[model samples]
Target: MTLQQRVNELVRACFAGIWIESHEHTDAIAELAGMCRDEQWRLVTWDIERGLRGPSGSPSEHDAGDPLAAVRAISSLADGETPAIVVLQNFHRFMQSAEIVQALAHAIHDGKQRRGFVVVLSPVVQLPVELEKLFVTVEHALPDRQQLLEVAAGIATEDDEMPEDAQLDAVLDAAAGLTRYEAEGAFSLSLVRDGVLAPSTIWELKTQAVQKSGLLSIHRGAETFDSLGGLDALKAFTRRAMMNRRSDGQAVRPRGVMLLSPPGCGKSEFCKCLGNEVGRPVLTLDVGSLMGSLVGQSEERTRQALQTVDAMAPCVLMIDEVEKAFAGSASGGVNDSGVSSRMMGTFLTWLNDHASDVFVVCTANDVQRLPPEFSRAERFDGVFFVDLPGREQKDAIWALYRQRYDIDLSETCPADDQWTGAEIKSCCRLAALLDVPLTQAATNVVPVAVTSAESIDRLRQWADGRCLSADTPGFFRKEVNSGKRRRRVTTKPSVN
Candidate 1:
């Protein structure tokens, strides 16, 4: 339901205080004002600059611009019949004051008996401890597809400026998580720059929008499944599983995968490419940035970040090195005072319950750090093990990076032993940078198989027969080496 509808019912039920978490206050206030006018109710809005604006738009004399006086004046606008609404815009800025808290407490208590309601509107929901129980939090959602198309139509007025029906889906999809204001600006910018409204400008603006929260970072690169060399099984599964387009109203639950691999594997690269492969945006969830210095702030940020992920639906959510991200959760949070534990709980709940069509891709080098419960079924469709590239896979990876680095195919590539896609790319990059052959450059590139040998061995042993293979179609099976003797000497006669 819209914020206005929700607030209308809550106000009729005598909810004295309502906290609206909204980024677009102008639109929200306009909707609220129209609702109040239609219902023939008394409405007044207050802010630090305008103080209180009544039906006449005149500044109230109750200490014009004084927050405390404006809050206290809500009682004066109350009556026995028609309900009165007092909107405090950006009231969270003044919530730090104890006196204002006391005044608001008094006002809310009196508002119930007098048919007056206090609505706090802010970009964030930061309810103070004193008013937490009194206020009901409501989220103002981002513009939907239909609303975005309407905004697009308003901007691209010319006949040829607007995209056609089939192409307009991409434009609306690009503006999915944007505000109406942002959408208008994007549409106008696209029209002015390209002489046509397009999704390019909207996606460019969306990257900036997603980065502002310091939680989710969006990747809209040109990478696709063609960019990666291996992981055919993984690519096929995700391509077939992700519901990029829906058929009916029945909601499809989210299906995620847990990827376990040693460092330098194609896990991260696969995630970045999966979005473009499936016609969706790739959102990287940064867990470290979610931490906050104040109490409960970290958990709140976690909730907000997940909410954002939900809002940007039909997208890929990539959480890289997730085992280390929530390590404290498995350790019982003795490190960060259980903040990681709470964050983990919130994430696990969302992973199981979120109704949005977000394909979660979590990559981890070391899965042992994660809690045992995290591997439970129903949370993810499968746990895939991305092993080091085999001979044929390495050839493909080498060919990919060779073309990327402008290396000639005439010169035979050097021998690569247990090197990952990343190491191959690094080798090619170093060869190109140093003007050396692949053989000499390969000397400088030590594989993760060699560096983290023990850890890799343990991981390989753990994932063997227990996880699905990224290269194959089913559960991964460890291959027995059984090295062949080059040329056996005739020393069998001397066997003692």
Candidate 2:
């Protein structure tokens, strides 16, 4: 059901209190107020500073200008008639207090016969156990593509321009994941930056728009499918899965993908390429950045972040190096004071039940450190193991890096499968810096498969049959018994 219909029905059913969680409070509040106006219900708002505001027969605007008084005023309007809606702003701060709890409980039961309901609006959601059952919570989503397109069209009309509809659609796609206010600001900025109000200008302004949110950032990555050396199977799988164009029949859900591999194995690069391949804008989520200092702030940040992702439906959401973000928190609760547990719970729940069209691509290096519940099949569509690149894959990677930097790979290629794609790229970069051949660069580099042999073997052991291999068996062989090859020791020390 739509937010409007849901709110109307809930109000009709006499839902005592309705709590809304949203980042775009202004938009949500305006929408709900419009709905109330349509239903002809008297709308009132409250703050701690305000006593009681709205149409209570007296029709006095009680402390609307004062934050605290506004909450108090709205809270005091439980006995009013004429079908009233009391919107209490930031009242969650006092939800834990005994007085506020009792007041809200009494107001809920007392307003039953009378057409009155209290609405709590906040950027964060915090409910004491006493009011959890009493209040019905609804999420207020950020502006979606359709809404953003409307905003852009409105802006263009205001500016008196008759741009092509395709250009407008491209602009809307670029502005995805942003709220209404953010989209408007971005559109204005894009118009001014390009000096022509062209669709290309939207990219420049989009960078600025995403920077302000500290949530998911839209990436205009230059990397394409051609940049990737191997993993043809993985690439093909994602290409079909990420298609947003609906087929004749109901399109299958794009089950999320999990990339499991060691660091510097090009997992992150694959994610970015997937977005580019799918022809959709990519949003990168920095999980560590969401951690907050204040109480309940982390959950609030997560909620906002996920809401932003959902608002940009039919897009790819990449969470890089997620194992560190959700590492081993289920047992031994002494670390970080249970913050990890709560974060894990929030993330897992979202991953499991999220019905939005956002396709998640989570990359993790160490499976042992990850929570067991996260690896289950239901959480993600497929879990692919990104083992060390084999000889042929390494050759392709070497050729790719050489071409990228305009270097010759015929005589300078690293012949072995010891290095990962990232390591190979690093070697090529170092070779260019030193004005030397690629083999010389290879001589100075030791891959993780060499330096951390045991850990790499363990990772291989765990992924042997449990995960999909990035390379074929002809090039990269797994030992029959141990599931890993013996590490090669050399006399010369290698570069990082």
Candidate 3:
């Protein structure tokens, strides 16, 4: 619902205390003013700088620049027949004052009888214990597509500056989560930088915004599915899922996929590539950075990060090495005083329930360390096991990397049995860096299959018949090699 409709109903119902969380105060106040004018209700606005201004366009006697006085003055505007609204601008800053808190509590109780409402408008809602139950918090939503298009059109007035319908739609998509002011700024900046408006400038501003937040980072790269080889099954599944459209022509969003594999298996690279393949921005969420030093801060940061993810819809959220992120969640409050557990719970709930068009890709080298509930159905579309590249896949990876590093295809490639895509790339990089033969460069590279042999075996065993194969359809199975035929060889060895 729009802010006007919500405030209209609440004031009519005599809800005395209303808290509006909004980043764009000018737009919110303008909306409230229009609503009040239409409903024939008296509207008064207050702020520390401007004091209290009544509907008559004059400062009231109670305009003392004091929040306590502002609360006490609400009763004077109360009337049984007509509703009155008092808007407190940035009043959360004064919530720490005892006098202001007590006065607000009493005014809210008395305003119910007189049909008066107190609306607190701030960027954030910080309610004191006394007024918590009395106030109803409402979020001022970001601009929708229509609003963003209007904003773009308003800024791009010139004939050549305005984008066509298709380009305009793209621009709107880029401006999805931006506030009204931010959208205006982005559109204006885009026009100033480029002769016409484009998504590039908006995305640049968005990346800077995410970086400033410190909770989420935006991945902007040219990497596409063609850059990586293998994982055809995984790529096809995600593409089909992301491309599926509803009757309304909106794409059906896939929940996500849980990728389990050993190190250097292309899990992270695939995630980054998938975003570009699907035409969505990839958001890299670092769970470790979400951890805060203060109590309850970690949980708050988790919520904020999820909110940001939801805001930036039609994007991919990549949580790399998720097992380490939630390492201590299974233990019951033993380590880190339950911070990890609470943060994990918050993330799990969001992952399961979020309706945003975000495709989540969580890569984990060790699924055994993750909670079992995390892999349950509905949390993700499927749990995929990415094993070492097979012969064909390895050859394809080598061909790509050899071209990338200017290695001669005629030069016999080193033996790459059980080598992963990452290992192949590393070998190519080392060969180029040292100006040595591929075989000589192989000495500097150690494949994870050999370094973590026991762990890899255990992972393959656990994933057998349990997870989907990233390379082919159906459940993954570890190929068991029966002992080579040794009937005649054993006798020959004994004779020798």
- Best candidate, TM-score-wise? 1
Model 1 lDDT tens row, 173-232: 788788889888889888888898778888899889889989999998999988898899
| Candidate 2 lDDT tens digits, 220-295 | 6878878888877577767777664575756877868888877788888888887778777788998887889976
- What is the Å distance of residue 197 in model 1 from its true position? 1.6
Tell me how many clashing residue pairs each candidate has: 0, 18, 0
TM-score of each: 0.93, 0.83, 0.90
- Arranged by TM-score with the best first, the candidates are 1, 3, 2
Summarize candidate 3's per-residue lDDT along 1-496 as a digit string, tens digits.
Answer: 9999988888877789999988788899899989888888888989888888876558966665778878888998787668888999999999989888988888899899988789999976678778889999888888778888788888999999978877877787788777889888888899889978899999888788778879888887999989889998899999889887888877656899999999998999998899889889999998988988866778877887888788889899999999999999978558799988888899999998998989999999888889899999999998999988887789889999999999998988888877889989999999999999999999888888888999999998898888888888767877677595211100111233
User: For model 3, what is the alpha-carbon lDDT of residue 166?
Assistant: 78
The residue pairs found clashing in candidate 1 are: none
Off by over 4 Å in 2: 46-80, 92-109, 128-133, 158-166, 191-199, 244-250, 330-338, 408-411, 414-417, 473-496
Ranking by lDDT: 1, 3, 2
Per-model RMSD to reference = 6.1, 6.3, 6.3
For candidate 1, the 10 contiguous residues with the lowest summed lDDT are: 485-494
